[model samples]
Target: MDPEVIGAIIGVLATLGGVILAFYLANRLTLNDSMDSKSGWRKELMNIASKDEITLADIYRIRASVRYYPYPYSETNQLSFRWMSSLIINLCDEYFVETYRDKHVASYKCSNSSNFQPNVTISPENDEIVRIICRYLLKYHWEARQKMQIFRRGRDLMNIDDDEPSEDVARIIQLILEQVDKINSSSPQNIFQISAADQLKDILNTAFKKLTITTRRYLSK
Candidate 1:
């Protein structure tokens, strides 16, 4: 081989090696940053769990008329009910996204909403916004059930104890729909005012506990 040709080949190889090294280092740094951001949330969550506290204060409790309130989310629930529901739903949604901080799934979760909006570009596995919402709510239900005999799904009546979150969520959702149909003999009327507005605060408290539990589980993984 000519001396000049050999030198040229060595230069090309050196350049290629540098490019590859640069790429690997950049990717490594990004991954580490992602992990650190995740760890920050997890550590904060652990502290919250250790203290067993929720940051959100109870909703305003003064008795007021809700008879003329605008329709809240296609439902007729009172203003306080909607606000409380949306708050917990949004919190659960946040933790669900946190679960995938290391992956591309983080952007799928949007804050400041009652419902989970599935991202169009996300894959099916990562786009389980609805399932994630239910799982979070179910966790709350399980915790609340310990204190109260209510919130029982039909599965409980059948003595079919199950630990699978997906299956339980599905069955509970189905049963809720079915029960809604059976109980309503006529078209549903708009509830101008919710009598149990005060109880929404209780629900919020239980729901936050579930968020702490589920968030910790995801961080551990």
Candidate 2:
């Protein structure tokens, strides 16, 4: 072969090898680094509870923000988990405060000659709030307790019941499945590979119904 032709062939081969090496390095670096794996409910739970007081309007705004940005892009994606955990914390806070805030009591005090005036004394301190706050604090601890319970049960059943995996998992799974279906129409059909996952999703949908039924039954009982 001519010298010029030989040099040109060598140059093309070197360029192809560089491209292949670059592709391999990219794949190696990207291994096991999925957006889902970095999501931790505890981190988000901390963020939610970091605030002392949260209002219903705050919850609504957080929820709306989450609904707006449905994808995870490192900094931007954490909004979903933070929003959900904050919502839970807010809801539990409201429930505790409403149920345990105070109870009205009526009393009468006698003054001289057949005259009595009603007197009321509000509790000096909200012990119930303190107790309920302790309970909320316990919920923060309960997240770890639940995980320990599962760990004790064994790692073999990591996703045994599916049950949304965690708040973060539930959020990302929806995004993943929606994208999957968008890319391939048949993807939806394959979503049922895990029966527990399906059941878990159904449970989430009817959670309110279950709450209502249980409340009614308890009232009857």
Model 2 weakest 10-residue run by lDDT: 120-129
Q: Mind giving the per-residue lDDT tens digits that candidate 1 earns over 87-190?
A: 33433334323333333334344445646543323222222323333343445434433433323576332112223223333343344334333333323423
Per-residue lDDT tens digits of candidate 2, residues 1-221? 99999999999999999999777655533442332237543344344334455433333333332234322222222223332334334333343233223321122223443455332221112222222333343353444334422232534222222222234334333443343333344334343323323433343333223333423343333
Can you give the TM-score per candidate against the true fold? 0.21, 0.20
Poorly placed runs, candidate 2 (over 4 Å) = 1-37, 53-156, 159-215, 218-221
- Residue 98 lDDT in model 1? 33
Model 2 residue pairs with clashes: none
Off by over 4 Å in 1: 1-15, 18-24, 27-39, 57-221
Q: Could you tell me which residue pairs clash in candidate 1?
A: none
